[model samples]
Target: MAIDPTSPPTSPPRDTPRLSTRDKLILFVLCAANFMVALDFSVLNVALPVLGADLGMSQSALQWAVTAFALPSGGFLLLFGRIGDLYGRRKLFLTGLVLFAAASLLATFAWDPASFLTGRALQGLGAAVIVPSGMSLLTTTFAEGPARDRALGISGTLMSLGFTIGVVAGGVLTDALGWRSTMGLLALFALIVLPLAPGLLPESRTPDRPHLDVPGAITVTGGLLSLIYALTTAADHGFGRADVVVTLIAGIALLTAFAVVESRTDAPLVSLSMLRRRTVAWGNLGGLITFSMMSTVVFVLTLYLQEILHLSAWETGLVFGVQGIMAVIAGSLTPRVVSRLGARRTLVAGLTGQGAFMIALLFLNEHSWSVWLAAVAVSLASMPHVAAIISYGLTVTSGVPDEEQGLATGLVTSTQQVGITIGIPLLGVLATTSDDLLSGTRLVMGIDAAILLVGAALIALGLRTWRSAGSGAVEAEPVGSR
Candidate 1:
């Protein structure tokens, strides 16, 4: 069927019913939840100095305030994803909201470093539960088609905007009302979302109530937690630190064990079969590369803007702020493009465009013109990210039964978090090892561009193989829907 540019993107299955007022409200709530999760990562960054002074924390200890949140957030995702599948998504999501809000309140009133860290850790746990559950809620509610694509597009946009908003808001809030204000804002957002969730969100779970794979959960969660810790630590201490080396090895061992356990377990936390699916496997690899490189791009640019060009914190925020706006615009338009081009091609275009933009940044310099150019490049880079995120989700969840939506959602979310956790250290190691900061930044950018280009090619080739195998019917159905 030819796509009608005048109408909303149509799904391949059939004409999906137009979204009702209630559906729109539900999308809003889910997107808000996702935005809250994404915002927490960057919002506290600007407040670190003030928070440290207030809590009597050392510079190194202050970094924990961030790491503390990240550890459990990334660690508990797979476990929670399966939990949501067996239990009820609504139940898990509501519990997460309450926990997040309470944690935020605790952080807001914290008088000591221990208290603050505890609150942050709890917030991470809440987020871990919320992200997978919320994503499952989204995928299950929006049928696999253009409607889902559009919904995912909005979700991707909010998530991208959340990070940028956090950067900007952290500076403004900390300056205006102190570091606690950032925590207070989170509390307020959580509180606002908590009450409406029960009414707006629908309950869902797998029909058979599959048995929880305890051993599988333990190995996978432990493995992921250990790996994230190593990456986080490596960002600060380098890859060679004794603890980092030990933890990385341990993470690998446990994950290897996890794969073994899953292959044997009747009710595995992750279905090894899902991993075998071309869309699920390659889409995730594409997502990992996209997130890892995008993060590094931002990290390098932050240093360039602040250290090399002497831009103030607020000025740096403004530069990236423009990029965020572009991301939102790109996200809004993506569903239409996907409707016309198909998800695989859309993903390829997005990845290719991102690489092109990153290559443009290799020429960046201390000149003011370069600053605007860098901003434009970053902005353009985000456009593809929006498409890739939405397409990847569709690719992973398409054809997946409702019972396993949580598992698919969990896998995608875990890949994203792990990608983010490793990006800084992975790229930072290269940049820091160079003779000069500029040289390192250029090298990293060049390498990232190459990786993205390669990823795009791989995805393109995978699509070609699928088409050649007489399985092109799968592509016509939806990116991932059977």
Candidate 2:
């Protein structure tokens, strides 16, 4: 007879208030890798022009340097996430570190346009492996409740800070040491982590291993790849382009096929049944909305500050510095906040506050007073935005059993990646279409605010503290779901 892998993962015990040295080491290793990935995501942005000139990449080809990293990272998450569970998370994590380091080296030494894109795509592949594997390990290592919440809070904080810092670092590094130095930096981080991760991290797996669901994996991976490619492409070229339209259609068709395949498969790559869990369902939606809207806010503001307001890059960075500080503040406060409000209400309150502040940005323009207030509002919004960012991870991972932890986290991380990937494009197209850049930006912000508030309201009405089934889900009423 075989054991049900859904039962709690074997461990000494859980719920200890203080972490042992080993526990801290585990957290450090995992959180550091995630932080590096977050940093790498944006570190290339400011360095893109310098990098392109060195490699002779054209303006059209330049975006591919970024897109190359994004495609595989967004596409293969579901497949690799489940692979880690079926194989070994520790094995998968270590392999990811190795791949990441090697890919970084390749990008560092990249001599031509082709080589650079290949290296970036490989780096993206490595990142796809790292995120879900790291998340599943973290969730399983610490049992649910405060312990897991706190760990995720810290993890979330570092990731947020990494993105914020990466932008500034990209500019400074590009100017100081040249563009390749940015690539070298990530290689350094991965090299440092690769050797220690194997020894420090505990290995865990699904006790009852089932055959890999090839059909489900194929459809989902293809769908996501196509969809993400389309989104990234549309960001640069308008949606009217033939490639964008065709890819968009193909992506939708593939995903619909994936759903059908999953329903029919005996051992699906992702357990569709789990989506019924209120925690899983609402939680993922919340995660997607929070990340997308927040990232959109940042993107539009970057344009408004630099292009519209004609602020220097340094001044723009200064205005948004408040966000980085709040990310740190939330890390320390999240555990206490979640402990008191519970993940459900904490997410709602965080979203509500974040949305409110987003609305406050609508007043922003050339007026000195409005500009000052708008800057302050974004900083104030950062508190709840960071809170929402951390809490949503807790909400999604809360009651997921060990067996499905990888898949659960895979879905969660996919939302995180896709949310960030899509937010700019989805709203950016809107911003570009408007008659005036300022009004367009303000319009985009208003729409973003509405989306956030509406999402928060839905989660509030839909999620409950009380568990109806042994499963984390309940019959959530849809209140302005979108």
Instruction: Give TM-scores for every candidate, taking all chains together and pairing residue i with residue i.
Output: 0.94, 0.92
Stretches of candidate 2 off by over 4 Å are: 1-16, 368-371, 465-482
Residue 214 in model 1: shift from native, Å?
0.3
Model 1 C-alpha lDDT versus the unseen true structure: 0.85
Residues 414-452, candidate 1: write the lDDT tens digits.
Answer: 988988888899986787666777788888899999999
Clashing residue pairs in candidate 2 (N, C-alpha, C atoms within 3 angstroms)? 277-473, 278-473
- Kindly give the number of clashing pairs for every candidate: 4, 2
lDDT by residue (385-466, candidate 2, tens digit) is 8788787887777666798889988998899888988888899778777778889998998999999999999987676433
What TM-score, to 2 decimals, does candidate 2 have? Answer: 0.92
Candidate 1 regions exceeding 4 Å error are 1-17, 467-482
After TM-score superposition, the amount by which residue 52's alpha carbon in candidate 1 deviates from its true location, in angstroms, is 1.3
What are the lDDT figures for the candidates, one per model? 0.85, 0.83
